[model samples]
Every structure is written in structure tokens, then in C-alpha cells.
Target: MEIGLNHYLVLSTLLFAIGLIGVMRRKNLLLLFFATEILLNSVNIAFAAISHYYGDLTGQLFVFFVIAIAASEVAVGLGLLIVWHKRHGNIDLDHMSTMRG
Candidate 1:
């Protein structure tokens, strides 16, 4: 049997679920970033699948922009994480509660 849009959508949904669970359960900043990446990737998969199904390039183009934005987010986020870790020596989300308003 050939793989179809439904298969792709189901896979995307599963990945999104896993990513959501990870985001909800993880306490570390680094792990949270990974979970967010997973969520972005799942959406990318869905977009590409639909773009292919419809023979349209819009979804694929949107995926590329999303990827670029995700990359920039990772770069900025990791930079902040490094600074936070250097100053606090830990990357736990609980530690972030001490931030000043």
C-alpha cells in the first residue's frame, strides 16, 4: 500500500502529541527547546505532505520560512541559555522563577 496524506497527517499528529508531552513534562531549559523543535518539525511534516498532495508550493515555502525562524529561535535561545547557565550553573525551569520584574 502506498503512503498517503492521511498517513502523513497521522504521523504528524503523533509527533505533535509527543512534543506537547515533552514540553509539558520537561523541567530543563534545553529539553524544552528540543521539545519545541519537535513541535515545529511535526508541523513542517504536515505542511509538506499537504503541499505535495495538492501539487502546490505554498505549504513547502511556508515550511522553509518556519524552519528559518526556528533556526533563529534556537540560536537566540541557546545563547540566552548559555548565559543563564553560566550565571546560575543550572538550566532548570524552576530557577527562572527568581527573575525580577
Candidate 2:
């Protein structure tokens, strides 16, 4: 079967759902960060599709910026996660309640 706009949309929707579920259910900081990235990427997919449909490049340009933002977010998130793990001796988010002032 040939792929079309609907197929792209369906894929984006499915990815969004998975990411939402992951964000809601996962406790690990790493997984939480990953889920956030997935959500951002799904938006990129939809924007690219809409741009293609309208013969406009603006949406695609926006997606590229989103991707750049997501990459920076992942870097910061992982760095924070590592610091949290080192301080707490574990990665369980529930145990990380205190932040020094």
C-alpha cells in the first residue's frame, strides 16, 4: 500500500499517544526525558506533513528548530538526571524530593 497524508497523520498520532503514556506512567528520570523528546518529535512530524500538504516550507523550518530545541533539552535533562542519581545514589524519582536552597 502507498503511504499518504493520512498515514503520516496516523503515525504521528500513535507516536503522540505512546509518548503521552510514557510521560504519565514512567517514574525513571531517563524515561521521562525520552518521552518528552518523543512528544516534541511527533509535533515535528505533523508540522512537516502540513508544510508538505500546503507546498510551504515554513512548517518544515519550524520543525528543524524544534528538533534543535529537543536536542538541547535532552542534553540538559540527562545532565540533571545524572546529578540527581549521583546525589541520591539511585534514579528513582519518587525519592528525589529535596532540593537544596
Candidate 3:
């Protein structure tokens, strides 16, 4: 079977939708972070497909930058998660409220 741009787009759409649902429904910050990663991966798939179709390197270059950013985001986000866990002893996002302050 020959995969085309449309196929790639459809797959990415499904992935994004699943990620959105997870992000909206999950109470755990770790799960929410995983969903965000899925969303980023979907974007990368679309960009790579477009770059391949256009025979241009720009999209691939953008993908590389995106990967770098995602790596940094995950690292920083995990660090924050650790700190929050240390203070709160939990990672449930719903358990947080500034009114507690």
C-alpha cells in the first residue's frame, strides 16, 4: 500500500484528538505531560510529511528545532513536577488551587 500525504494527515489528526482527550480528562500532571508530548509528535509527523512532499529541507529543519524544544520542555517540566511533588506529595493537577494560599 502506498502512503500519501492524506494518510499522514489523517493519522496525525487521530493522534492529536486522542492527545487532546487525554489532556482534558487526566487529573495527573504526568499523564497531561504525556498527552502534550503526543501532540508534539503529531505535529512533527505533519511537518515531516509536508517537507517530504515539497522536497524542501526547511520543514525538516523546523522539525529538528521542535525536537530540541520538546526535549528541553520535558526536562524542565519533569524538574518542576519533582519540586511540586516534594512540596505537595502529589501530582494531581485538580488538587491544586491558589485559594489554598
Please report the candidate that would top lDDT against the real structure: 1
Candidate 2 Cα outliers beyond 4 Å, as residue runs: 1-3, 98-101
Pick by TM-score: 1 or 3, better one: 1
lDDT of 2 by residue, 18-92 (tens): 999999999887888889989998988999998998899999999989989888887888898788777777786
Q: In model 3, where do residues sit more than 4 Å from their true spots?
A: 99-101
Q: After superposition, how far is residue 65 of candidate 2 from its true place, in Å?
A: 0.5
Q: List the candidate numbers ranked by lDDT, top first.
A: 1, 3, 2
Encode model 1's per-residue lDDT on 1-101: one tens digit a residue.
99999999999999999999999999999999999999999999999999999999999999999999999999999999999888889999998997662
TM-score of 3: 0.93
lDDT tens string, model 3, 5-72?
99989999999999999999999999999999999999999999999988999989999999999999
lDDT of each: 0.96, 0.87, 0.92
Q: Which stretches of candidate 1 lie over 4 Å from their true place?
A: none
Cα distance off (Å), candidate 3, residue 37: 0.4
